[model samples]
Target: MTELREAAPSAGTDLLDERTRELADYCAAMTGRLRVIGQRLDRDPDAITEFLHEPQVRFPVQGMLPPQYRSAGEFPAPLVAASSTVLGQVVATEQVAYGDPNVILASPGPSLSGGVVQALADEQQRQRYFGRLAAAPTHTFFALTEPAKGSAALELETTLTPAPGGGWLLNGAKCYIGNGARAQLGVVFCRRAPGPWGIEAVLLDTSAPGFSGELLPTVGLRGARISRLRFQDVAVAPEDLLGADRSPSRRGLYGATYILYRFRPGIAAMALGCAQAACDYLRTHRATLPRQDRHRLDGVLDRIAAVRHRTYAVAAAVDAGVVDVAGIGAVKARAARVAEDATRLVAELLGPASLIEHPWLEKTYRDVRAFELMEGTTNLHTMAAFQSLLRSRTALQPAAQRAVDGAARH
Candidate 1:
């Protein structure tokens, strides 16, 4: 038993090592793509998409995440790192990499590569698809929340009806969809037939007929390239029915849940990154500012570090599989809270400069604000974590009963 326990960690470590290497490879690929994109920053979207189709930039759609951990304990550190790196590169080049905003969105369906096929125990296919998606800048979106339905999955009004030829027809409008305006492909969750259990995942080709996108003007995160998407009887091939054909199998649900779970850590990472950016900006500008604000700036920095540490710790725990979904949700909520607080603190410390367009603090502030809304909103996650803890407490009763029964037997 002791040996088994000890070996478990080794196994996990090995898995982590393998994933790290894959991520490193992805990072290298992304670096090459960004170099190419750099030259075409001023080019139109069609040119950019064409540039992405290059062999060096194209990656397979599979192997993006460990299947078991994809929705549960996987940190998706590679994807998050790639995103941060890409964001930094785009910002540095004075261009927005809005090719696929859905890559950052936490919906579970296909990997970031916009592959139409779903994971169904096909390791080779998964790896191939993951590699392809990771290598290129494919804009993807989570078209779940609608203006009418909000975050209520059961209230989703988007419909996916079966066509005569095994294909599906999608009709709905997605609002405030990240990457919607520029995404080539997206994973859209729609009510196949509205009822108690009607939600199904479907992959949509954004460039297909009857699909259109309009940019939404927003006060914050203006550069995020958010837009509203309209699908009017959009024709989808049979291959795009990602997990929608099943009779709601447990495995399918688990796969979906796993994807949602993985996003918690990613959302937390985004928050941490935004908070760090804010704090870094404050630090860089402290010396140039008035002496009176130095002490306040220092305090903000300390708070930011503390918040960042907690976020990293939670992220590490999720990656290590030490935390379950509820724990991850709690951690995500906490990370967002800390990020929000830290951003506000830094903004306060920076005063007028924090709001200026020249400084990244403003961008950080806006981006961090979005983190609070992403994955699961802080309030919703808190409620979910509390409910999960309650369920766990109830589940402990049986274990306690077994212990008592064993004692009596003795």
Candidate 2:
């Protein structure tokens, strides 16, 4: 938050700054490519399972990195702006998902993975990896979540032991990795030893020996090649360690947490997209509904607007260096619930036609549900946000009090 305050304007009027405008323009231009992907997904529900292998399709999404990540000449504003643009991309994808839900999955991997690189990597490492993205399309994954631990990232059982020769020997598995199956490189979080400070991160070449993955079947976001990655004695040089000398300490955890804080708002925006699309469709098609139903529709639209504006406010806070980890969780948890509620409301408006016609509504309804589960589950985040609010002395403040109440039972 300290960094953002110096970089961005205070959270007030004029939320749609140059950065948001640039993101909107970029998304508008990329809509056609996304539409084409959605069309392909419509023909084949599991099309995202194999879509990553195609250079033509993959490169376009990756190529968007240059515009999205362009420097903003400040500390956290650049990060905040890039994250804001990511939200725009997610919105675009959700808009596309109105036609085919699978298409939204492809673009999120790069944004999620890129955040890891930006947060943990040294200048040399950043230039080396991100430069490839600027020159051409490149895919990367953030490997932290595990099957046994789920959202408890610090509880990871993945081990990185000293190699017999020199570097390191990695042996463990990561599940639900966004780009795990097809990424050229990945940021793998591992326990350097048997304690909290032992938590460390490494940037590993996914093509290295003993590294492999298989796509996992998913109910939604079928276009994403989400997989469980196995690292069986995957060898890495000392240079592959992330954060220069910052590993094997709480620094790694802080860095990773920072990355998550920045990206969660974008996930909120993805949910916003789902909600927005649903609201727009409902407004247009549900006009002849009963008076009571129309009143409910107005409530839904108003709620959507509130969540959308709150998400933008979070982005502004991120730029201003004022948002905390709990704040991120609060925004995302609220947005996820809002999006789910909006989609469900739209479905109910169909009044049985939902089961037959409006395939777009049906897919988005399912797709939006995944938002509650992704990044972190709604219950986990809600509980975390509530706990944080309880501990904050600022809880007496009106805004902080509202946040606490919002996260509870929502």
Query: RMSD for each model, in Å, please?
Result: 10.1, 8.7
Residue-wise lDDT of candidate 2 within 86-205, one digit each (tens)? 444433333343333456555433556666776677777777777766554455788889999985866989998999999999999999887678778778888877667777788877
Error in Å for residue 304 of model 1: 4.6
Q: Model 2's lDDT to the true fold?
A: 0.66
Which candidate has the highest lDDT of all? 2
Cand. 1 Cα-lDDT:
0.52
Q: For candidate 1, write residues 124-217 as lDDT tens digits.
A: 4444444444445556666767878765666778888987777888998878776688776667777776564566776666779999999876
Superposed model 1: Cα runs more than 4 Å off: 1-137, 164-166, 194-197, 244-247, 250-255, 287-323, 352-354, 397-410
Candidate 2 TM-score over all chains jointly: 0.79
Winner by TM-score: 2
Candidate lDDT scores, in order, read 0.52, 0.66
* Candidate 2 weakest lDDT stretch, 10 residues: 1-10
